[model samples]
Target: MSGIFKKIESLVEKGKEAHAKTWHNWAGNIVLEPELIFHPKSLNDLQEIVKKAKKHGKKIRCVSEGHSWSTLSVTKDYLVIVRDMHQIQVEKSEKYGWTITAEAGATIKQMDDKLRQHKPPLSFDSMTVLSSVRASGIVATGSHGAKCAGASISDQVVKLQIVTGDGELHVFSDENDPKEMSAARINLGLLGIMYKITWHVQPLFKLRMIDFQPPIKSWLYPATLKEFVEKSDSVEVFYWPFNESELDRNDDKLWVKQWLRTDDPITTSQAELGMERVCEDLETRFGDKLYQFIVKCPESTPYITNLLWKAGPVSKPQNVVIPAPDAIHYQSGIDNILCDDLEFTFKADKDFANVAEEFNHIVDSVYAYAKKGKFPMNLAAEMRILKASPSLLASGYDEDPNAIYCFIEVLAIRHTSGFEEFSAELATRWMKKYKARPHWAKAWEHVPGIKPYLREILGKRLETFESVRVKYDADKIFFDNKSLEEVFYGSPKSTFTESHL
Candidate 1:
């Protein structure tokens, strides 16, 4: 520590109390024990910690709720908790619509609750199902909602207040250096710490949930698939897996949730989304006896996939109208199911770009792995469409000029044997075939050649990210983990110091 920053030790000790302990993300994925943890209540306090970290040659990271699935926020040297910096401001303008300014520590749930109090009420465009994540974290990792127009959380951020490595406060917006702004929109927590965020919110809206069951045999009818996406504001397709013999009987089915904004004033929905409600709709769709059997023998999942898609009191509510948030988010079911997922975006060949072919390929991949004795996927493969973004490193952006992007993800329960291998194999194939970029907020460390892949696909965009990264964090104080350095900077694992020292 003595060879690092000269006055860092003293500066860190000045503004806040520090502790040493082990920390893990909300998903229990990354667990690391840092040398020191500081709780910063104000901007000045955070500045002092950053100054100290720079002076002492200590790596630093900031965590509020630690909801990230990636290891982006883990640090072995120092960690700053900015949870106490939660503050929010609201403003209205006819041109930009409603703008909400909130500190990095603010949560989506908190913002959503506050936005609902507006005259017309306001809601964010894209959001994760779980509302507990910090607002800045959402943008930092490029989290996306099921909506097509908004794309990802970064799309909603209009401005950012950042504290760089030099302990200086800088504000960024689209009007200021559009390239840097694009890079900063999805910071990856590398450029700097997000102190505050300003988001462009939409007026209060209601969404009608339509639960429709499409037979597995014809779910991907070309015309029907096009209408499914074009008619709905947001669409989520739950492709349920089934046994081979069931395909012979043509009993398999796909469950679909199509959400569209409505002016309707009614709110009566059934089959809340989560494992707790697993049987809430299933039991009614099929007889209780069969439902119980599928529950017990998960391998028999195909028998009930269609029944759940059948309109009923559960997900198939006829005319349910709920607030934007209710219709936008559903339970993640993470609490009950110890699951892991492999999510990536890609544009299929033009001739095979439709959902049916995509699903066929996905099914083919699953069966390929299954034939090789890879473990069967437990939960249904969750699929969603994403729009392209101008952000430099936006993973969902289609690299091809006219190509469209869609997110394909598969969940494997922790209890399942070979869960890790199964996911890794699938991710490997997706990246190899599609040149996919793994989601920043998910378990993506194992993706093959992800670093070189990103470097190749991103091309100059990677350079732009590095240039801005160095501009904001020249000393690399934010490079908390060796994995990030290895991937982003092509640093050798043996020595983290190549240029700084």
Candidate 2:
């Protein structure tokens, strides 16, 4: 009825390939040419587009930045892009801490910068997929911070405003009318378009980071991971792969310990110079060609440290406060390099041996695949721990208070080179053996029987999620894409069923 809706309709009817090709994901993995891409500027504009699509019976799906490694955001129908809705409003609260409200399109960097302006600034410890934060809301998949005691970005949500499939807007929060806040926290774009989210902030605190290299097996076993967390405010491990010969064993891993403390001003000039020195040494020893090759792979891969070990080990300790937001999320050098390329996450039980066994299984599988000419060398896996949340489809699922998040990263290469099949197989085997749940934003598909598998394992929780979906989305207008449907409901045709069978 509105002029904007009419213009959107004209664009969809045109069905131009040029329009379709313009949409690309962060890793450049999925290139979708949607029939219509809606760039709505306001909540009203979004509602009109959705209403028209529902009325016209056009299959539609919403996409953020396509930062997800999976094909979840890809669709041939109408693809909603939420980039223009970047508005942030900060308010001081007397009872609770500060509350910051932001549109879905605002980047994590933007949120962090804005929050810093207030006294006793609050920190959100979650890492974000590069370029992916622009097109989606912050709470969609419950993005997490790295601190063991820290909560995911979703947990910080105090309020949310979502536009339902039928173009009805709903507001929910703890203080206001509560309607399944857990389920709403990580809705996977299946519930509705989240227009705005408000986060409760903590007082600003400085984090002291101590970086040390230790043998992963000895220093970062299951027990060690728990102990490290208990000892420090936050702990993260980075395992580097050995050279091409011994990819199974990690040469050295970087362990960073961050603790809350008063500001102790220190100059970063020395740390920056050290990093530069290390980089220069690497360049000299490995040569530019090999150094470039190493930079292409994810930092979690065991191969990275192998090259470093071959060159030489750091003689002295390194200490520095993360200067910028990106510095904290993106580690220096190889860690930062690989993040721009690929990302994946899996949820597993909190058993260290179980986790270690799975890592070994994947490593062994990579070796076996390499022998058969099916493995790719340009990838890495990061291991992180998270506490379970009440969200239905959350990776942590049902478990003890805490769970582990293993993020696997691989370099993005041309699909024709068999990397796609290799990655798929890797994901399949991991899920099959470990019963791992893939990250919503990362690359993965719900194979056949996964729904049933989840139903069996998760039991009533799965049923509750389905019931909520049925109540909220009867016609499935919100779930226009296959991936969303598969994740929330069931997949009619699943590769898991045939492959597993």
Candidate 3:
């Protein structure tokens, strides 16, 4: 499309990955064809690409593992795949304590494997359920685990190296500049292309994972759920509609998973864990086949979900002590089944009175809609309890570290009828009732009135992020996506100026 591609090709070891081939996201929901794509090997390669792009007035966007469900990583200009920059190192610093430093492209699994193999073993304070995502991308989207005392993954970032739109490398850390660090913690790739990252880690610990199916009416309330969360290091709740009874419409049971840090010896050895994974992989394959059939017959979702629950492990009870990493990443093989997810996070007060009501409302809404012959939600409604984060734009942002927050999401198989409308309805209600904020990396672009609502609620915080963003990329070279532009710049249209190289 332009001669600048020739100039940029001379700067990198590999000319380009693709010229104009179509690219799709992990879910195949968003697709685009960039004029040029590159997998730079080192910092110099990234710097050279950035400089050439800036000179040619082309925008740049870095993609991680392509797991994002939103358009945050979408760009038709210059796309960068950071897989080549994966290099991880474990460093012990007096000021920052023990940290795992790695290039921005390092996947969570790579880091987890390295930490587990260390002399004394090491692990992050919090981790996402999936380990295939890149570290930098995880932090940018504020992904998190269910640890009650732990915040989002972004909170664990101690240092970062980025190449700004000016084509200069800059390093920022909490020790040097907390204000700037706040912005860099979860900048959504607007500030620059992250080159490397340093994450806080701790001595590897064990967790006793226990699962129980309690009656929904008994432990699903605010007070009891509060006790459950307060007593556990990490807690997650899942409810599959029609799990208990389809005809009676009595989904009276809830599958609750809790993890508590313990001194107990590891009950599952590395070999055993590997074996378990193999078995689970087989199960996932079988489940995927069933899902394919259900996808063809969408109306059988409720019946199939009920059958799966009755036959699944959640129908029984189990407990085991395992390494923290193993427990944190509980399930795997999700890439086979594509789903649409909409997630939101809101602060829970000391007693969690409001959060409890809001959660109950979610369940009630599902049933209410179902009664009218609408089955917008067939998958599990998942919720996690996490501590607050200090990142300015994080969904769970709060001043107090001890503050409890609830991150809830509803998922549906891709192409499920009425999913978009259902999500929009819930998003609007949550925003108005609980002042909830949607997860940056999940589905939210189609939600009506979302842009104005975010602007109104995140007025000052958006300004703070914008101030720092301008300092790094004054010309807005990284602000090419319409979804992010709608939130920060109050524009729902692309401002990219096309120029032939």
TM-score of 1: 0.83
lDDT tens digits, residue span 1-501, model 2: 699998997766453212444587656667877777877778887787778778888655676655566566666777778877789888877755688888878876677777776666665544442323641444676566566555456776777788876788877676653446666777777777878887776655555667677665566556665566566655555433454335544443443435434377654655674676567556544443444554454433344445544453344455665433433444323322322223334564455655555555545555566556443544344555555565666765544445555544444333324455555665566667666666666555534355444444555666666666666566777676665554445543333554563
Better of 1 and 3 by TM-score: 3
Q: Go through the candidates in order and give the C-alpha RMSD of each one to the true structure.
A: 6.6, 5.6, 5.1
Q: In candidate 1, what are the lDDT values of residues 51-162, reduced to their tens digit? A: 8788889988878787666778888788877777788888986767789999988877788888988777888876787777788777888888887555678877888989
* Model 3 agreement with the true structure over 1-501: per-residue lDDT tens digits: 478887676644356455546677888898988877878888988888888788889898888888889898788888888878889999898977789998989999999999988877999888988888887789788888888888888888999899998889999888788999999999899989999989989999899999988877767777898888889999988877777776344445888899989999888787877887777677767776776666677667768878878876564476889989999988766666788999998888788887777667767877787778777777778899888888999898888877778898898877778888988777777776667899988998887767767876777888998999999999888888987777776743422112200
Lowest summed lDDT window (length 10), candidate 1: 492-501
Q: What local lDDT score does residue 70 receive in model 2, on the 0 to 100 scale? A: 59
Tell me the lDDT of candidate 2: 0.58
Error (Å) of candidate 2 at residue 405 is 6.1
Which stretches of candidate 3 lie above 4 Å from their native place? 1-14, 249-251, 491-501
The residue-level lDDT of candidate 1 at 113 comes to 83
Ten contiguous residues minimizing lDDT sum, candidate 3: 492-501
Off by over 4 Å in 2: 1-21, 125-132, 135-138, 176-179, 243-263, 266-317, 322-327, 332-351, 360-375, 399-434, 446-452, 455-459, 487-501
RMSD of 3: 5.1
Clashes of each: 2, 16, 1
